[model samples]
Target: MTTQVVILAAGMGSRLGRSLPKPLTELSDGRTIMQQQFDNIHHAFGKRAKVTVVVGYKLEHIVEAFPDASFVYNEQYDQTNTSKSLLRALQASQPGGVLWMNGDVVFDPRVLDRAAEMIARDQSFVTVNTAKVSDEEVKYTTSAEGYIQKLSKTVKGGLGEAVGINYISAADKAMLVRHLQRVDAQDYFERGIELAIEQNRILVEPVDISDLYAVEVDFAEDLDRANLFV
Candidate 1:
């Protein structure tokens, strides 16, 4: 029941005003931001999961930072969303279930354990959420029961930022690839999962991770605050 992690780290993160990719940003700990994330994940899963990081923008720095992790290049990152970035990573992963996540996102290691526990329970879909979004705009929309109804930016009363933690079981892997094919290359990955759930082919197991402290930085202010997670 080994797991494989596919981290989508191919974005330019223009919001961060950085000439480099977000993952390569410096952390207070003296390690690059991505290195801190790996440190957290490794502390949780150890060698139980083979980790593969998908790189596109400033990929060289990413390779240099985490040389042991497998790497996949996504040339389309500038034009496409994370779904495609992860698809490229999947092309190189073990055929087992995947713990798919965003490299730029920060999450508590407990969220990783929760995701793995749910996936091991024969769940077809798994995610983490919170109800603490302060913005008038909703970052994501999910049912009270934790089913993500929509991931659009316009959706109000947003459930919260998607924790970006997931468990893609082996049985659900085909569904991921098929959804990518049916949808255009530019479509976001979560939208495909929602569509699959409409066909009753996916089940989302939600973990209320509001208590966990995590953050996603696309700005200098956030970079200054990253010490909360580190």
Candidate 2:
């Protein structure tokens, strides 16, 4: 089975207050966040896995950073959100399941290792963390059977917060593409997944990663926190 890894890195890091794209932000280890992500995915999937990066803010810079990666330009990246960028990437992906990761996170390589294991088991799941769920976090509620029942930042007391990493089958990817096309461009990509769950077109399992380090960089403080783990 062919597996594609899609990295969504188009948006400008306005909140981070950095002139560079979040993916290009220099980490404590000197490697950019996207470079770390590429390394981790390569470590888990080897050379066969195709990596497609969606770029918008600084296209030339991102392109130069990953010359080997296939690129999809999100022309309206400033007006849209991750959902639209991901949709563009998914549409350009190969005919198989895809491992999706937001470009702004710095995480333990084990997150990719475990995500691949879940995909190998023929399960589609979103990585979640038992770490403190703040109001700003993208939260989700899972059924007792481990399927995600709901997903939203406003969902108080969720099972865990979404780690912005997930595996989606080709079938589900088709469904998501269609759903996302009909929704608001500002919606997060997970909104489509929530709709799929509601329509019974897919079941998203939540895999816990509380024991591992996964940080979503949204602000200067978050970047500092992520640097601690890096």
lDDT of 1 at 129: 52
TM-score of 2: 0.96
Model 2 residue 158 distance off true place after TM-score fit, in angstroms: 1.1
For model 1, the superposed segments whose C-alpha errors exceed 4 Å read 134-146
**How far does residue 225 in candidate 1 sit from its true spot (Å)?**
2.7
Q: List the global CA lDDT of all models.
A: 0.71, 0.88
- TM-score per candidate, in order? 0.87, 0.96
Model 1, poorest ten-residue lDDT window?
129-138
- The superposed Cα distance between candidate 2 and the true structure at residue 51, in angstroms, equals 0.6
Model 2 has a clash total of: 0
Judged by whole-model lDDT over C-alpha atoms, candidate 1 comes out at: 0.71
Report the C-alpha displacement of residue 87, candidate 2, in angstroms.
0.7
Model 2 misses residue 180 by how many Å? Answer: 1.0
